[model samples]
Target: MADSQWVDWTKTTQSKNYRGSGSFATFMIVGPVCFFLGILFASFPYDFPLLWTSDPVAPSYYDQLETHLRFVHQSPPLIARLLNIIMTVGFLGFFIKLFRPSEANVLFDGASLVLYVIGAGVYIANIVKGMRAVSAGVWHTEDFKGIAHDGPLTGEIVLGREDSLRVLSASNTILALVLVGVLVLQAGQWYAERREAEDNKKADQADKEAAERKASASAGSGGSGKKRQ
Candidate 1:
């Protein structure tokens, strides 16, 4: 009976932890999607006109491009920093869970952590680096010969800047999708484990019921034999 109680407690605690982690993973997934959507909304004003323009490098056209890039450089880092903090906490939680004796789904947790780390790597390598480059005036690098030059930027320089922005946006969108995939994996694992637990509980209850029935039958037979004697 004591052993059964312990097993029940363990299963209950494990189920709670699994559900909590799944909820956290859902939050992580939502963060990236919202960030990407925000970027699209913020850039739409300039991007829409630029998309239809024939001369993207013209002073008038490139000025709007610069404005867009400036917004990208300035706005995203704040949200990125916040997301990074949340991700770091999530990573540490999972990492700690890896060594926990109570954690039954080691493979599932390990796989989720691996994918989470990969997503972080992509963010740092592509998204973070791209933003830093934009902040450092990538457009004026060649024209100003590594010196800071202020004023209207035009010609191929603006075109290069536009291309970099596109690449940055694309990479960020991909990263968000990858995070969503991780969330899906976590959800699936949680469902599988929950189902397994329910099945185990049912099996245990069935065995207990069968043993009780057998004991009652034995007691009835013993009483009848004594009365016959």
Candidate 2:
């Protein structure tokens, strides 16, 4: 009963759009995925068999794992890339809310699901494409061969595939930017909503105070009338 009244009041005052809920949902989903990716990239080289390379500073295994460096799959990618995945779930939540905007979303948080799944999908696809460079054996930019240092012994270690990797990175960057921009817009909406709620609360409180003042004055006049009679 008390819960229902509080809920009813919230429904009347707040916007039915629950898209904002997704922002936080995306945050949770993206967090784990990025953590996993961080571990994957950080550990993959060490776990794989030893590869002998002459480059003093660069670890041979690290150079070899470069075969898997993707624009949206590395440390930098983990940041916004993971976030966008979570945002996808949030967006989905918004879509569902349109059908039943006022309903309680206690069990399933749809917005988070949509944003997270979509964002994760993007990261997966891009990362796989990066791995493809190795399987294809073209030794393209992401291919370990491309980044290998050139010297008297190894002539342009990657053969010749700079343009391709640059293009792949650029394309993936665009995808990330699109998803991140959507999240940023969501944040803006949340800020606006919070402000609106504050204003409404203040207005409601003022109205209640005015009513109380009026009632007090009316009771005082009635008591004076009785005394004079």
Candidate 3:
């Protein structure tokens, strides 16, 4: 059984925009990154991980190439989408847990959701088809530049119709615009919530002060208002 630790999904860890660029960005950016690296690997299998060392911490080799495709790239689109859906859930958790203030958060949540769906659709297709081509030697794992390669690679890779991919690529551009919208909305919500909270706090303080003043006046006046004459 998997680790039984409980996880909460409501507390955001980063900005809504941070989460927006999340899964979609991974599929959008890294999908192509892998293709490029796959090409590099196809062309120079020995030097694959050298050129693409990333920031803060380096990307794992399996991550660079997409480890899941090692076996399941042949499943139907629905099945792959199922896998994509599961992973996207985690991506969303990253968004919800860190993203707060609902202003940007909700908007990004929508964008992230859309990204998860669309990007996953495209990526899963590409990965499955691309892997077949690669395996058949049509797209050399090291065909980074495609300048040199034995004819062992199959034609599906070299001559594959990537027009659908172009359409799929639109998911990134759309998600990016949505992320901006999310940021704007998040700011608005933050400002509104902050103002409301401040107003409530101030009102409570004012009421307390008024009560204290009333008590002080009553005590000072005592019962000898008319000098007891």
Candidate 4:
């Protein structure tokens, strides 16, 4: 009967821990996706609004094969806009997950939440800027010695896009740092909990052993008393 009760209690504890772990699970999943997408978006060649009017470099200063390389590669504008929106969505999802209650300490959770929120906002702002540039029909650009603003974008629009991109670069860095912080804090929490569990298990075993010894002693005493009687 005691063994069955022990098993039931262990199952109950496991279920509780699993339920409390949902937020951590969400972090593990969404955090990597957001990180990868952020890096990929940042690495994309054409995130700014610029236009290439001529060859990338002087043909006279380059070899024949190098001179033929076009700096301005045309891409589908609609597809680019769609991808920007998708990036916004990804950041939004990541931000939402930050608020999910986890097993971390309150301070650690709050710090992670603040950092993640800032990062998500910055990334979304960058995406929104790109979307605006795309709508203005001037987001595609390439590396050229004589790069010009040939697209239908104003100076303000271009500046805003550039500024947002720069800010997002910084934000991505912060987000990566926050990921590390969250992992460390949660890992510590898990470790502490595990240690407490092991300690409790040891104490329970000691108690059970002591109880068995007491029972054996009592039985022996009772039998001796009976024989004496």
Best by lDDT: 1
How well is each residue in 100-177 modelled by candidate 3, as lDDT tens digits?
323344444445445445544544555445555434543335544443333576333343222222232233334334
Put down candidate 2 lDDT per residue, 13-122, tens digits, no spaces. Answer: 25544424444543543445444445444643433342223434344534444555533244465675655565455455445443333333322333434444565565
Candidate 1: tens digits of C-alpha lDDT, residues 64-113? 66665666668756776776776676676565555432434455556667
Better of 2 and 3 by lDDT: 2
Among these predictions, the greatest TM-score belongs to 1
Say which prediction, candidate 1 or candidate 3, comes out ahead on lDDT.
1
Position 44, candidate 4: lDDT: 38
lDDT score of residue 91 within candidate 4: 46
Better of 1 and 4 by lDDT: 1
How do the predictions measure up, each by TM-score?
0.62, 0.46, 0.35, 0.46
The models' CA-based lDDT, in order, is: 0.61, 0.49, 0.44, 0.47
Model 4 weakest lDDT span, ten residues long? 64-73
Better of 3 and 4 by TM-score: 4
- The candidate 2 region of ten consecutive residues with least summed lDDT is 46-55
